[model samples]
Target: MSREPTRAAILIRESRKRAGLTQQALAEKLGITTSAVCNYESGASFPKAEMVFGLCDILDLTPRDLFECE
Candidate 1:
């Protein structure tokens, strides 16, 4: 079955590409390993609420933008 993309997944990808950041680079910014970033992009895991703030800060986005569920 096909799965719809979650907002977190979409935001992770869009922000990374817009910033010209490789997965490794984004992981470094978030103080995580590249595998974590890869998982986030692949929709295998979700960031915690606190981590969401950090992600927004790093990606230059607001929580609303990242978590929008429509």
Candidate 2:
């Protein structure tokens, strides 16, 4: 099975796509840099814990959705 951290990154990327958001757009909403979003989607980095809820809101995902990968 894939690790939760890796799965979280994939979930975030897929959720963002489903929401019709570009990295720049999600970054704008999160008040972060586009490169940060790129890094997250690329599995280069993870968001801070406090940022996860906001990310979920913007991506139209529940926290469970981000962590439920197999």
Candidate 3:
């Protein structure tokens, strides 16, 4: 089934862009595969808690920013 992108997906994608990092670059920083980043951005899967923190750090954002999409 086609799934709409989740809030987390939008947050990750926007934050990554704000940080000026491409999916490949973000994946390298997160030590994950590019497809993993794509999957998260596409809302095909959710990131683990640790990954959330990692994203916060790499994206120069807070958990609140990532979670609340503010």
Candidate 4:
């Protein structure tokens, strides 16, 4: 993967941290594998479109933080 992190990945990682959650904890809550959480945080892959909204709620991030705003 590229060295640069995706904006959404960075935001996810930051928000998870801000929420005081570990990768495993977040994965458990999201019903995903810890490795999958790692991939998302590392920007190895992107979360699905439907998942973004769930992530925003779980991580307490605004959609504007994970995505572009007009």
Best by TM-score: 3
Q: Compute the lDDT of residue 32 as modeled in candidate 1.
A: 90
Q: Report the Cα lDDT for candidate 1.
A: 0.82
Give me the candidate number with maximum lDDT: 3
lDDT of candidate 1 over 20-46, digit per residue (tens): 899999988888999988778777787
The runs of at least 3 residues in candidate 3 whose Cα sits more than 4 Å from the true structure, single-residue gaps closed, are 68-70
Q: In candidate 2, what are the lDDT values of residues 1-70, reduced to their tens digit?
A: 5334477788888888999989999999999999998888877787887787899899888777766742
Cα lDDT computed for each candidate against the true fold: 0.82, 0.82, 0.87, 0.82
Q: Which portions of model 2 miss their true places by more than 4 Å?
A: 1-5, 68-70
- In candidate 2, residue 28 scores what lDDT? 97
Clashes of each: 0, 0, 0, 0
lDDT of 4 at 51: 77
Better of 3 and 4 by lDDT: 3
